[model samples]
Structures are given as structure tokens and as C-alpha cells.
Target: MGASFFSFSFSMVSFSSLRSSLVPTRMMGVEGQWWRTSGNHWRAEGRDDRMRGENEEDSKLSLDFTSEEKMEIESIKTYKKDLLDDIQKLKMEIDSVMAEILSFESAEENKTIERNKQFSNGKKKFNMDPKKGINYLVEHKLLDKRAQSIAEFLYKEEGLNKTAIGEFLGEREELHLQTLKAFVELHEFSDLNLVQALRQFLWSFRLPGEAQKIDRMMEAFATRYCDCNAHVFQSTDTCYILSFAIIMLNTSLHNPNVKDKTTLERFISMNRGINNGEDLPEDLLSKLYESIRNEPFKIPEDDGNDLTHTFFNPDREGWLLKLGGRVKTWKRRWFILTDNCLYYFEFTTDKEPRGIIPLENLCVREVPHPRKPYCLELYNPNSQGQKIKACKTDTDGRVVEGKHQSYTICAASAEERDSWIEAIRASITKDPFYDLVSVRKKKVINQTPQD
Candidate 1:
């Protein structure tokens, strides 16, 4: 298939529009010293001393577990690992067979191929009789307006040495390639209307991050998910519309909460009787088209990070530019800062943590007059025992610089930097019991009344 026919529009918003749309909101009700257990679960240890004293007995009594219960827990753990392994195997099989999944070529594609063959034959004839072909091309207005100047330059200036003519044709090919790229960009921009509409739906549910995540998801879907480079579609509009449905279906499958009406499961169930690629139900396709166009998005609350129940009470979570380890290039990463650790996500929409940085025994300092002004440094006490992929080290497994591993982190602004720095430091030196004592003093003072 020709590149023009095969290419489907992937919409993208302007940089200014994107920036204006996604403004990070301040995290609310975030203050507290959270307790981390060995199981990596976070619990509210209580905000003050009086609250801690009240809950102490309840906490201590919960720690007792019987032998039978412990054995049952071990069995469940083993079962979970087995299930995960099975899931990995299934994913591998899907990836391996993706290329071999046959999809039929349409009548339109066959017609396009025929047209291309005729065009190639015409090009061959044109090369043989240049003068007559040029006059005919001009009369028919078949040539691109941009190609006129190049043609004039080639014949008028550079005389027809076979090498010079070949070189000129190569330049013409480059121009055509550039023109194709421009068409792609134009189509993408035009499709931004749909993208913006989709963004509105996401933002209506307060899921701006989810909307952004879809862009990354689409990129992965286009470039990595399908092994086949060529996607078969009836029309260009149908192509992207179906792609949107696939994305929605993919997201629905991954989410456990999407169980009922208007779900991907329902769509799949309706199409269970038909073959996958060969005979897709037209009614189901119509439903999907309507779903993408008109249906109101029902984003699950679980789309956002649930750090409240985690071992670390995440104070802040947002997209930040992070420098690469090997390439030393900057790229955006979803940063989540907890009391004891800093975690990064591949995308803001990702549920899995990509990397973790323990703040234990690390020094936080400001970087002055750096490439990015709003930057801070985390100096690890020693890189010997710590595993940080970004840090360059010696063969002896020590940091190349010295004993410590220093990471430079950037925030969106100076104010954000200060807040991050303060939160990180407070978590590092925070006395979990200090609040308890302060609360007790306040209670005592209140009990004394007007003295």
C-alpha cells in the first residue's frame, strides 16, 4: 500500500493549548507521618500524640497471627505468583502470534495497487520522452506546484549528464517526501478537533492525566503493540475511529471495574459469535463508532493514584522532566513523592512504578544557575549499597565521582521546588511521635480552661 493510503491520522494538540489545559492542582489533606509496615502497606499512625495513645492497643492486638493463618497466607502468596507467571506466558504468546494474525486486503487497496502500477508505467514512458512528457504533465496539471521550480533549475542550469539528471530526480523524490510529511501534519492538525473534544470529555470527569495518557497509549499501540506495520481499514476516517475503539477496549480490559453496560466486555460478548479479523460484526462496529463520537466517557475513580493506602503517603504526584541515565537527555516522567521514597512512572496514566529512589540517609540540596533553574539535588550518603541506574560507577561497584550518588531533579517552578524540598526534608527528619507530644500539650492546655 502507498504511504498516503496506509497512514492514519493521530491527532495532537498545539503546545500552547496542551500547557494551558493541564494545570496541576495542589494536593489536599496531605500532611501526616504515615507508618510503613514490612508488607509495604501505609497506615495512618495518627496525626497527634493523643490520637496515637488512643489507637495503640488496637494496633498492637492486630499483630497477632496464628500458625494456620500464616500457612494459608503463604499458600495464597504462592498461588498469586503462579497466576502472574501464567499471565506473562499468555502475553508472550499474544506478542509472538500478532504478526501472523491474518487480515484481508480490501477492494479499495486492490484498486490503489492497480493505479500505482499504471502510474509507474507512465513514469517509465515519461523518462524515455522527457520533452513530450513534460509538456503533457504541464497541460494536464498533474505535477506539484513546488516541483516546477526544481524542474526549471535542472533543465535550465544543469545540462542532462545522466548523473546530474539522476541527482535532480533524487531531489524531486525528497521534495515529494517532504510534501507527504506536510499532508500528514495537516491531517493531524485537522484531527485535533476530535482530540480536543476527547480531552473535554476526560477533563469533564477531572481526568486530564488520563486524557494525556491516551496519547502515549495510542503511540505505543501504533508503534509497538501490533507487530504488523500495515493496518487494514476500509477508509481513513474508519481507521482512526476504530483505533480509538481499540484503545477504549484495551483500557476496559485492563480495568477490573469495567464490568457492565457500555463496557468493552459487552462489545466483545456481542461479537463472540463472529471471527475476529475476517468477519467483524457491522452492528458492533457501529456501536463502537457511536461510543467514540457521542457517548459520554465514564472514567473510573481508580484512574488516579491511590497512594493513601500505600506504605508511603504520597504528598505530591505530577509530571516532571527527568534527565536520562545513558543518553543524558531530558524526558517527561510522572513523579510521585512519598514520605520515604520517590517513584517515577513511564506515563502519568501508568499504574506501575518504573523506578524508586529511597530518601533514607540522603542529602537534599539546591542547584544554583543550572540549565534548569528550578532544580534540586539528592546526594546519597554512599553509592556502595544503593542501586541507582542513573549513577555512573567504577568496576569495583563504587560511584565514579566518589562514595555518594547525586541526582539532580527539576520541578516546574521555584515554588514547586521549595514545596518538594520541604516535604522531602520533613519526611527524612520527621519525628513520628513529635505530633503526639504537641497534641497532648494542647489537650492539657484546653483542659485547664481560663486560668
Candidate 2:
């Protein structure tokens, strides 16, 4: 009952950890583009593109639905679906049991009468004192060090690991009602292995408990898939481990969006089965401890825009390509060019239609098209992809504003301000259209220009 919540600590920390644990989520492949239908296929950058719509969101299912379903998959759409489903089922069951208990409690006329009813009902609750339960388990030698660490934080000197909890919760609060409710339920029992009991309770509801099980599963998967040369069990900073599992979940046979947050929450909520609180119906932080052993994470959002696309730029990290003095990005050119700024791709006299053409900062991008560009765009040997212009940076690898909005033209150079225009014409000629070039780089970012 919210009334019995007298005076106890709440764990804002659990919520904080849950949020931080979401580090390194997953996402889709490149986006943006216009296309045309060719027979049953769609053509973009000149390649045979595949369809991703499982089977028309409203169409008849084929016998080979799974394979047909995999089309247009970013990377891990199916796996997330199943995982989330399992979690959802667990959550509902947990909710059912808690609701039953609360109903029985509420039926009583008074606090003592309610206690009597609960006792008669044979359902025990954990005592309100967190340290009592933790120390009880420790004295019985039932808890390992990690469990003890969790225990030490509970009912700690600061009336709950307020400092550490604050780091996780990111705020200070006297008591989180959700944590208090959980603590009150936990305090009524004496012989239970709190951690193990939590595990069994979660599984009863369909969630992961026992930090060991999640660690082992994650460790094994990481070695095979991520080649992560690290032991998950060795440390509590399991962000890397969780990130790896998420990658696997995304890469699994039946993955959904690896970054699907609802999918992640639903799966954990349903399968691991932490009973919902009568005092606290929502606020995921209440169930965080029960789910965090495997370091549960937040699924990444699907908003596709201004992404951090990584690439190696040969010219400079701050430099960018500008066309007519304006930066002409295909979809987004966040990645730096891996090759150097100015390179000469010379055409020899022996080569047909020969004229020495210099190629500098030619970047190959995914373009507005998702499918590969049509190869026909490069029918001529002298022809390169569409040339989007680029430029060098100032002292600190910063893109200069002067050239950002400028354009390049052959005749405009007579004014001295049209140097970029002059460069564009010189970059291409009889080739009809310039080829789209891609520069290699380390990686791109999903951030806006801060300064």
C-alpha cells in the first residue's frame, strides 16, 4: 500500500543506469533516394534493388514468408521482434499476480486487518528495511560479491547509495516511490535469496535475472560475432557487453529493429516478469534492477537525418566539397575523404578519347538512392561519376564559411570571386555529366555543427 511506504529510499539511480546502459545501440543502413520501377524491380544508382516490405503490410502470406520477409531489412528487424514479444508476455503475467495481491490487500478494512489478510492468504512481502534483507542474506553466506555490492548500496550509510544511485539516476531525491514500493515488498521475507529470488521472480514474469546467465550468454555471443576480446563476467561495466548482445540481437535470424526501444522494453517487461507495483504502475526505473543484470539498453531512434557518416578525408578533416560555392551533398556528406585533396587521374595518349583530366577529392557516396547507382552512368571510359565539389579547411580543421555558399563556374572566374565556378567547369567537359565520387574516411557523426 502507498500508505505503508512510511520512510524509505528510492532509486533514481536505477533509471540513470538504465539510460546509460543504452550506450551503443543499433540503426538502419543509409537512406534517401528517388527511383523508378523496372519490371518487378526498382532501379537507383543503376543496380537491382531489393524490396523490404515483409509482404506488403497487407498482403497474403507465402509459404516461404521468412525469406520473403527478409527483403529490405536494415540488418536486424526480426530478432528484436521475438525478443520484445517474449518480454511482453512476462510483463503481463507479473502484472496479473501483483494486481491479485493488491486486490486482496485492499479488500481488508484496516492496515492491521490487511496484514492479517495477507498472512492468511499465505503471500509474504519483503520488509521495508533494505539493509535488513541484504545483511540477512549476506550473513547466511548466500550472496556473492556482486550481490553484496548491490546490497551495500541498499540501506547504505546515505540511506541508500544516494551518491552512486545519483550517478545512475542523474538526480537527487529523498525516496523514489517505485524503489520504496519494491523495497517494502522485498522486506517481508527472511529466507529468500534476494538476488536468486529476484531472478526466479523475473523468469516467472519472463525476464533475465542472475547476472551470470546473461553474462555467459553475452560472452559466448560476443566472442563469435563481435570478436570482442573481453570477458563479460570480469567487470560490472557491462555497457560494451550489452552493446555487443544488442548487435547480435540485431544480427540474429529473427531480429526486428535492433534500435527499437519499445521492442526492447516490451521484451524485457514481458519475459523477465518483474511484477508491476501497486504503488508504482509505470516508470521503468522500478523494474530496472530486475532487468539490468544483462545491462538492458535503450533502442536507438529511427529518425533519419543529419547522421554521422564516417569516412577518411585525404585533404583535411575540416575541409568539404563545394559546388558553385555551395556544398552539394548527395544525401549527406558527413564522412571525411580518405584520399588526399588533389590527385591527378591522368588519361594517356594511348587511351581513346584521350584528354588529361585531373580528378581531385572525388567522393563516392550512397547518393539519394538506396540501391546502387546505374552503371550506365559511366558508359564512357573518360567519364567518372557525378562530381560533387569539395575544399580544404582553415587552421583547426574547420570548414570556412566563405566557400560554403559559393559556386564554381568557368567564366565567373573573371571576377576573381568565381574561382570555385571556374574549377567546376575545368573538372568536367564533353563527359555530359560528372560522376558522383566517394571519399574514404574513418567515420561520420550524427551531430550538428556545434560552433
Candidate 3:
């Protein structure tokens, strides 16, 4: 009798393919003798003792191989699991790097925008000096001499006495100077005080159906005096009436003694000398006084010394409700429109603005809203047909990038909305380059021979 033996081998293979190729191949083995001692039983005969020993050895080898194969399978499974974990970590790192790259790109874009703005502003710096540019207009005869007189009054130039005021008022200098002097004395107002009062009156006065009258008068004044308008002076009478009204309001507002306060009767009495002894319409006076009484004019403590407080000014500052960017909610903010920039604050008295929006390359229009009335929107017309982002301010006191391509604001009434839209549009065009171009064009026209 002879014992049988078997041998086995394995090779490295992919985990997925290992299962399919795991079948053991057949191998030659030593022959062994077998005899039947009972039904379905095989046993070595007594004389084949050495063969039995060999058979036991073969059995041990088979058992050892099976155990080793199981250990290898477990090791391969652990390696696969570790590989998957490393792949997951690599993916996360890649995502983090991508985020940082996007952040850098956004910052670079903002820097470029800021540099361009500075360059544009530098070119317009000389034009922005209202005093200098206005003087030039007067010398070149683009504006009336009276315009120069008004600028002198606002700038508080040396020798700006009552005589100068009379000069600015032209033929009616006597009555106008009397009224202005009396008003100034009654309120103990300095030239600076008067300037601030005029600003407060303009910002706070609003009468139903009469809003356009004030706007038109101011437009005429700006055209004649501030060089902010290109059109010829529409009406000197309108400008005179506006100046008188400002004086009367300053008298009405500034007296500290409540007992001697200027009443509507006093207001009417003081202004009766205007327009050649004809009184202002009683109805208009009554309404204006009522509005002022209801909301007494007071300049914010912070804006007391601002140049915009003067009459030869181009600013529209007040409170308005602005829509939030991320929250999509309405918030009341104090807004100031001046010098081709729109700035907003959390409160009217805040010394520093929360953010500033450049008026360049921007347009404002009234838009219909589903849930809110008297809505106006500021947006760039060159957005290439994308929905504009809402305006928002970051911690650095500038508009956050990728946040505001547009701003939607709400006013107290439709008239207020329209007024804001008009003011914003006017500011967009009120630049030095426009003023020079207007003057040159007027010069060319005047030099041409009559037809």
C-alpha cells in the first residue's frame, strides 16, 4: 500500500477576481491501498502500516493550507478598506483647496474694481470743487452774475454783508434784505446757522401735490448757481420765492423760547412783504406750517458742519426703508446722496456711514412690487441679463462683493419714491465733465452767427 499526497499554490490577484479563481487545481498524489472492512468504509490492510502513516501526514498538510488561505483573505479585506478611507480623505482636501481658490479670485476682482473707481474719481477731482467750478462758469459768462453772488453767500465769502444779499436779490433787494435781516435777528442766527437751517428746511418740508414745486425751484437754483443743471434758468421768480421761504422757515424754527415762538400768524406777517407786498397763499402757508410743526426741522448733530448744509448744494439726505440682502427684510436706514455716492447709516446721528454705493454706471427706476408699495430699484443696466444681487454692507464699510448688483428701496409714498428717483438721476449727471461740456457747447452756440 502507498500513501497519497497533495500540493497547493496561490498567486496575488485583485480582490474582485480572487473569488472566481479561488477553486483549487487537481494535483497528482501517491497511490494508497484500500480494503473494505464494512459497508462504505475504506481502510488500509494490516500489512500497509507505512501507508496509513503517510495518509495522516497528508491530512495535516491540507488542514494547514486551509487555515493560511483564510488568513490571507482577511488581510486582503483590511487592505481594501484602508484604501477606500484614504480616497475619501483626499477628496475632502481637494474640495477645501477649490474653496480657497474661489475666495482668492473674488478678492482680486474686488481690488481691480476699487482701483478703477479711484482712477475715475481722480480725473473728476477738480470738477468736484463746487466753489472753483462755479467761479469758472461765472467768469466764462455761462451763468448769470447773480449766480456768482449766490455762491458767495453760500460759501460765506469775506464781505458777505447785507449789501451782498441785496445785490443777489436784484431789484427787490430792499424788501428781501429787510425780511432776511429781521428773520436772522429774531433767531440770533449766524451765517453758518442760516445755512444749516436752510438744509433742514429743504430736507423736512413736504406738502401733498406740491412736491414738484420745490423740486422745480431747486432745479432752477442749481442750474443758475451750482452749475448742476445744463438748461437755461427757467424762472428767477421761483428762485426768489424759494430763498424767501427758506428765511421764513428758519425764523419759525430756531427761537429757543417756547413762549415767544413764531406762530403761523407771525410767519405770515413776516413774509407778507414778499412779491411786492402780496402775501403767500394762506392755504399753502397753513399746510407748510402744519407739516413743520408736526415734524420740526432739526439737522442731525453729525451733519452740522457739512458743506451740503449750504444752499448752493446738491444733496438729498433722509430716512428710507431699504431691503436686506441675505435676510430679505425691510430695514429703516438714514441715506445721504452726495458727490456721486449714496451712503447709508443705521441712524441719522451716526457719524460714520455703514456703507457707500457709487452712483456711477447705475440707474434708478420705479418698480411694481407684489407685497410692498412705492418701490424703487437701483441696478446696473449692463449685467448681461442676469438677475441682480441685493446690496449689502460688510464690516469694512464697503459694499460686499457678489452681494449687491441692485438695491430695492421703499418710500413713504409714491411722491417720495418719484422724488428719490429724480434726485438719484440728477446726481448721476451732475459731474464736472458734464459742466465743462455744457459751457463749451453754449459758447459754440453763442459764437455762431444769427440765421
Candidate 4:
């Protein structure tokens, strides 16, 4: 009975172990099925959420990039506007500087003119006597005996007043154009003489702010004597316009300042405002410029005694090629023949002469140059001593010595060369005494009974 009970208990224990193992296997299969179903759904939902978050992040990054690009464009626009403002400011500053410079120059010129006028007035007040003035001029070598004789003749024979004689004598002493014009009018000068006088008056250094004076003078002269007179144009305004145009042309041609030069277009624009705000005919303007450029106003020959009375007056002045003595090179010089001296300057506007060649003993003759045409030479036949007088002075008032014995010059053309030669010869022989002597001889012959 005890063995049978032990066997049953052992079977019961084995059954219990087998059932425990089987129950664990069944529970594992059921849990695997549950995982396959619910776990897949949860994983799919998580993956969708991650993809949506990534898309939102990408959109946000794109929006940020666009905003950054817009900011960069606005920055460039702002920078460009700033640069333009700077350029505009710079232009305004430049214009202001230029205006100030012009104003200063004008003021300085006015001061100089005023000082000169005061000095002239003081001298005039001090020297009131005409005879004393004549004596003074003669003693100073400003007038030769011949010029004095002419002055006497004009006073005694021509019945000219002391004022006219003084004007003529003091022409070189800062005479005004208005005074000169009055003198010319009093003499009742012919048209040619009038033009010659005007030409001489115009051949001077231009002063700052003198354009208005020039314009007025030109207009007055044109109205009085030019073909564009008021009678020529039915409308007075038209005549004035024409006269203004002529004045503008004269200014452009005569002004020596290179910066003041104007082109045809600029010239037209300048006049457009004057012609009732209408543009002038291009062809007409062009033709005027061409004509003026080709045939400038020239001082005609004086067949009368107009030039004979004037002493130390400029006879011929123009550009010439001068042979340098030391450098052995050709340099352009402005030559002016006055009285018995041939003065040269580096520029036409130079107040001082570079050298002076006395025509008293010098003779000018055409000479053949190896490589130049229209050449002439001025030499002293009597001596080999220096012919050119040095004009440059040292601080101690000593004359610098760089003079040459001879001068070789070249002109632009044969006509110019011949003109210069004739002018120089005339100047050398020019003496009012010779004319007086000739007149006296003729009078003596006439007074003598015919044989």
C-alpha cells in the first residue's frame, strides 16, 4: 500500500511540472499575437508624427532663408542710396569752391583797378600845366623832340586844345577807352581810323569781370556804325540780339584764357536765352564763327598822320619763332615792334619783355634758313657787340647778361615776313621831324618864285 501511494504522488508531481511548462508556452503564443497587432499600429503612428515634424522644420528653414534674402536686397538698396547721396554732396561742394575762387579773383582785380585810378588822378592833379607836362614827358624820354614838335603843331596849327594834346601824350599812361573814344570823336576820325583805333584799344590784357564792359562797348559801337544798326532791323530788339551775338564772337576770339574757350554748341546755348528763348540757326552761327575765325578784325594801314604823332606805339605785334642763342632751339615768342625797339615776350600777356633789340643801328633782312621758311635776321652791321639788351634784372637792380649779337626769326608766311620787315624799317626811320622838314621844304619851294 505504501509503494502504490508513492507512485501516484510521483505521477501527480510529473503532471504538475508538465502542466506548468505547457501553460507558459500557451501564454507566450498569446502575447506574441497581441504584440504583432497593437505594436505595428503604435509604430506607424509614431513614424507619421516624425515625418510631419521634419516637414514643419524644413518649411520653417525655407521661410528663414527667404527672409534673409529680402533683408540682403534691402541692405544693398540702402547702400546704393547712400552712395548716390555722397556723390551729390561732393558735386555741390565742388561748385561752391569754384564760385568762391571766381569771386576772390574778381575782388582782387577791382582793387588793382581802383589803386591804378587813384595813382593816375594824383599825377594829373600834381601836373596841371600842359607845358610842364610836355617838358616832363620829354625829360623822361617818353616823347622825342619829333613828338614834341607834333604836339606843338597840333596845338598852334590844328587849333587843338590842351586836353586833346594831353590825351594824345598820356595815351601810354593808363588811358581809358572812353577817353580815347572821345578824343577820336573830337577829331572826327574816318571809319577806317575809327576801326583802327578800336582795334588798338582791344589789343590789351583782359581784366576779370570786364566782359560786361566789353559787351556794352561792342553794342554801342555796333548800334552806331555796324550794318546791324537799328535801321537794318525793323525791330530794335532784333538789332540788339544781332549785336550781342557779334560781341560774343569777339569775346571768344580775343579772350586768351584757354578755360574760357567755348564750343559751337555751348555758344549756341549761351545765345539761345537772348533770342527770346528760341534757338538760332545752326548754319548761320557756324558761318559767323567761320568767317570771324578766318578773317579777324585787323588794324588797317594808316595813310594819314594818325600813327605819326604817337610815340613808342606798337607797330606790329604777332607770334614769331625765335632761335634761342644758348639752347640752339626754336621757341615761339610774341614780338612787338614799338618805337625803335623790337621787344619779345614768352607770352602775349607777359608785362615784361624777355629781350629788347634796339632798331637804331640794327637792320633786318630776309635770310634763307636750312630748315625754315619765311626767315629773317636782325644784326648790327657796325659792331659784333651784343645787340639784344637784357631786360631781366637781378635783386640788386643789375641787368642780367644773356644777350646775343644777332636774332633769327621765322614768320608764318611770306606776307607776314614782308610786313614785319616793312614795319621795322618804317619804325627805324620814323621821325616827325622828317615830315616837318618835308613840309617846310615844300613851303619854301612854293614861296620861292618860279625861275
Most accurate candidate by lDDT? 4
lDDT of 4 by residue, 39-68 (tens): 121111222113335455445435433565
Model 3 segments beyond 4 Å from truth?
1-313, 384-399, 431-451
Comparing 1 with 4 on TM-score, the higher-scoring candidate is 4
Candidate 2: C-alpha lDDT: 0.29
Candidate 3 backbone collisions, by pair: none
Error of 4 at 441 (Å): 0.5
> Candidate 1 — worst ten consecutive residues by lDDT sum?
203-212
How would the candidate models be sorted by lDDT, starting from the highest? 4, 3, 1, 2
What global local distance difference test value does model 3 have? 0.50
lDDT tens digits, residues 33-132, model 2?
3222223232222111343553553242232124533343323445445555767798999999999988878775576675555433321111223334
Q: Between 1 and 2, whose lDDT is larger? A: 1
Each prediction's RMSD over C-alphas, in Å, is: 47.1, 42.4, 29.0, 30.3
The runs of at least 3 residues in candidate 2 whose Cα sits more than 4 Å from the true structure, single-residue gaps closed, are 1-174, 177-232, 238-240, 243-252, 256-451
lDDT of 1 at 255: 35
Q: Which residue pairs collide, candidate 4?
A: none
lDDT of each: 0.45, 0.29, 0.50, 0.51
Give the candidate order by descending TM-score.
3, 4, 1, 2
- Best-performing candidate as measured by TM-score: 3
